[model samples]
Target chain A: MAQQTNNFSNWISQQIEADTTFTLSDAVRSPSRSRLAEGIFPTRKDEEWRYTPLGQILESSPDMDSRSAVTPEFINKLKDAMPQAHTLVFINGQYSENFSDNQTHLENAGLRISRFSQLNSTQLQMVEETILNAALTDDNIFQHITLGLAQNGLFIELAQNVDTQTTLHIIHISSAQGDTSFTNPVQVVRCGENSHLKMVEQFTSLGQAAVITVPASYIQMDKGAGLVHYKIGIENNETNHVSNTSVRVAESGTYQSHQYLLGSKLTRSNLEVSFTGPDGHAVLRGIYLGDENQHLDMRTYMDHAHPHCSSDQHFRGILNGHARGVFNGMVLVRKDAQKTDAQQTNKNLLLSRDARVDTKPQLEIFADDVKCAHGATIGELDPDALFYLQSRGIGKKDAALMLTRAFAAEISQEIELISLQDYLQDKIAASLNEIVNASI
Target chain B: MLSIKNLQVSVEDKPILKGLNLEVKAGEIHAIMGPNGSGKSTLAHVLSGREGYRVDAGTAYYKGLNLLEMAPEIRAREGMFLAFQYPIEIPGVNNTSFLKKALNEIRKHNGEEELDAIDFLSLIKKQMNLVEMKENLLRRPVNQGFSGGEKKRNEILQMAVLNPTLAILDETDSGLDIDALRIVAGGVNKLRSADNAFVVITHYQRLLDYIVPDFVHVLSDGQIIKSGTKELALELEERGYDWLVDKAETQA
Candidate 1:
């Protein structure tokens, strides 16, 4: 296992070294390159990765030369979810200008959305500073790999007090036909003082593409600002997705995030949020539905470094057909962060006997005056609940579907966007229907 | 409308219902009075096809069809409704949608066209009024966070909407105040028709005051020990069940 970890790190380092077209600045690349050169990758022995095995990700070599095309109809269907938003498409980690919307109107409205390659010197410096200032306590090798090898991503900035009504929807499509593809997209989002921004990022793949996606994102919310971010991952079953996101909220600011992981052979999402000033708030909600040997892992770290800050997290998982899910969450209240209110909850449903879930919710409160609570639950559908519905004339399968959909609706309904919420609920129901039918 | 012959049941090899028998025809309302641990709930559960209950012997026939052979849903579609004593609180399933689905499923089984949203809303609104249910309860999840009275009222509301042929009320008056009991019994009376029958199971004679039963049966040790007219309930309420239990034991 140790040798395999070393080989995976070495392979990533070699990929970085061989790419002559690495366009990121030296400041961004050198630290990640040196870190990769250290060749210390995580194994099952590591506490943070005890439940997730990276064997499938390590064995498949990423083919950088392979490129496939996405049909316009498929892109249009994705766009229909957020039709009024500013849509940006990424194919194989490279921004597709032909498919993306023109952002001149947004630029005129003091909202800046630029590709990393097109960022000016000032904006690039801001991106670099945000990455450097992120409060990520459990930074792993995948983040460094993304920083060193990232080819293209967006750099979005909202001016002070500019609460744009239009959302920014970023769609990443991996279209690799024969060989396994690799993509590392680094996103930087900065919301100025008193600004509000809503962004939805969707990751999907074409056909049964073998893709490895290691993406990193850094977000900064200024005083009194608010950011609502949503991520939906619906990649092919042969794909491996590993992503890290770090966020910092200033005084009176709010950061809300919702993630839906519905597909992928293996997925590991690491999210960290810290309150840099007093009176900040964070709300996190997510759902991971896996079926048929899929492995989905979610890790979250909430740091209450300022007083009067509150964080609430609720995540759920539904697994079937030998699927496995893991939720490892930690909420840390610093000594000086008095009167902090932090709550973390995780609930999982295992539909089949072979399906499994490992949930651990932890809270470390150094502050004497704080309200901190964490809970984890794993169980099957309540037979009483099922019979209640069945006795009402609903078929057994339909009753099961209704109950499962209700389980997901608790989280999906929290999404503020109506269209996106409907889209996700439909996807969840479709996937659950397939699982129920197959199991029956 | 319903018939049971020597219906014996056990849970985990422990007998709960030992040779229970009952017969009901259209338009008849029969009240089964029993003490606690007398297999009252077991009979209700067994009739509804709940799991964990073994039917040791006997058969339940509904309209000349084998009721025990059908799934719970099939039994329901065949116009059998069981109003639970303690309604299951199902979070996330909206009450309105659940009722709509149930009603439509039954309608489809009867070769009738399904109700659209507008028609369903109208139908449910009427039923809601019949049970005096709060309008907000329709939007909430099924029975979640509901008061005991409200849950029972919701069950009556469902019974009214479903309009089952053979409706079994399993101690629906257990958790209700007098006023709630009056309203619930009133709702059941409103829905009573010549084409339908009811089996009201309760331990108290108070509910019988509101919805008077045509016949009263004393159930003891899983079997109906005494059968009499509605005056028998008042007699038992005045004299208590010990005299009857003692008489039945002496006869046995």
Candidate 2:
């Protein structure tokens, strides 16, 4: 039983064939599916890994279990933000249509949002059409996990010229505690030509158990369209968070993402955006706070595929108590993509003797007329500054917390929602206080 | 109000200050003039308790208390100020915040209440114009991207606000132009009174034209070889330290 040769793909094929929500074809027989599984399923030799070895996670083969009941505490958090916006709530990856719905009201019949468990044949066809019509042609790893094992998720659509003023909130709460309980959540958002959508997402794990949640999201921004996306990851240390989100910006469109990961035992985030047409712009920012042997890993790719586009990226991490971090960012400029302006910077502060951070900023530029600059700094708390603060009678812990909060101030204030920003600020400050106190 | 007796120091085991002695009573300006490598800055570092300066044998007194017995900030609170020749640059720490912290620390040490933010801001704004400094520098990081003259003027502006009983300007006129030097010295001149003493350290006699010290002392090999009136500074400007070196050699 320890060395069983029964691959999950064979089981996956049988499971889907028996199920009524999906249909299999000759395409499923190909090796691409297994290869994608092997890729996202961590092996010991992966370089993007090494620190976060998944051998421990795959020991029992965590599969989504029976749907978890949403608690009143989580319900209140979701209701506080967007009481009127069409919301989608998922408890342990199963979409709850009673509390949140996508197709309640729409300007046009074609524009809608629905949970994965309630999708019709036409909705599956629409997914096939969007995947076929867009630039994504390859079978990716995260997508493989989404289709093969994920139980339930969300699907969103915005028809041409349909602008929604309400903010769409996707709230994912997990209580995966016992054996063989892993949750994979998927969200697909598509904005038609000249359409607009605002997304506010929150990922939280209830304070019960050690669970792993892998969320994969795809957003398609059409020509002359715009999207404002903010993601808050407040998973406690018992949760291992893995998310891969990609956006395709059409001609002259605007897309932006703001990410905040307060603390987790292990976190792997992959964010990518492509400028599919000219005159596109993207703003990306991320902040992570790690302590007490927690490991946070993030890799981002900003593909400047079109001419006359601009992108800005800045990420900050505060680590303490042997916590390690990795930030790998790549900005790719194609040959014909001229007059592109891109800037990237990563700054991390190590607050303990054993804390470490590895940051690599990669730029692969083929064009000659682009302005690209990237720099990273890894440093400790300045003694002079600490002493300066201590000399003012501010306790050492308060001083350290203040400096850590100041390190993340510019980006935390960038969050559009005032309450969300303050919430994150308090969370980060509390984490810093914990680190400072434990050191003493 | 201050005294230093047999103050000896070294850098990397090589002796720099050999029994340097100096005294300043209240309401007096004492100028310590010397050649390029005469331990003038080493004296300032030792007095300020900057790390890595070996105080071999020395004693410094301010208002009859053990001056070097406390941390730099505490020494500063006891009305002893050393205007750094090259101020340290601290990025992300607001200049106004830095001054406010230092001011409050000094005030708290003296058993006085710290001023509120509104009062502190108004007080700093008043000093900003006194030193001909733009208020913009106060908003940015401390001493970051400041020009040589601006850094010097900022130091004096701090001196004006702290209102120390004993102010030591350690080559405050080193890199300043004529206009900046005159304005800086004018600011110091306004703070001059019977209660506060001054120590102006310099290698050149040009600053003497504005500050006009009451006593001029020549520091050679870390000891004051001679003490004279302001006319001696004029004489040293004409004859130079080379003349003094020749006279010491012939006398030896």
Per-prediction DockQ? 0.92, 0.20
User: What's candidate 2's DockQ score?
Assistant: 0.20
Clashing pairs for model 1 are none
User: Model 1, range A1-440, lDDT digits (tens) per residue?
Assistant: 24345445657867876787755688877988887777667889989999998887777667756656688999999998898899999988888889999998998887999877788888888988998898467767889888887766678999999989989999999988887888888899999999999999999998786899999999999999999999999999999999999999999999999999999999999999999999999999999999999999999999999999999999999999999999999999999999999999999999999999999898898999999888999999999999998888999999999999999999999998999999999999999999998886
TM-score per candidate, in order?
A: 0.98, 0.84
Best of the candidates, lDDT: 1
Q: What value does the lDDT take at residue B45 in candidate 2?
A: 68
The residue pairs found clashing in candidate 2 are none
Q: Provide the overall lDDT of each model, using Cα atoms, as 2-decimal numbers.
A: 0.92, 0.77
Off by over 4 Å in 1: A1-7
TM-score of 1: 0.98
Model 1 per-residue lDDT tens digits across residues B203-228: 99999999989999999988999999
Query: For candidate 2, lDDT tens digit of each residue in A1-440?
Result: 12222344444445545555433222432233464434445444555555554543444345554434567766877566556656777777767666676555664544687665567877666654454343332233445655555455567888888777767878877766554456677777888888878888888876556676777787888898888898888876767777778788989999988888876678878888898899999999989888887888777889998899999999999888889888988999999889999999999999888898989889999999999999999988776556545433344565566567778876787877676677777778787777878874
Error of 1 at A201 (Å): 0.5
Off by over 4 Å in 2: A1-40, A50-52, A60-89, A95-113, A118-143, A159-165, A176-181, A194-198, A383-403, A436-440, B11-15, B63-69, B80-82, B245-252
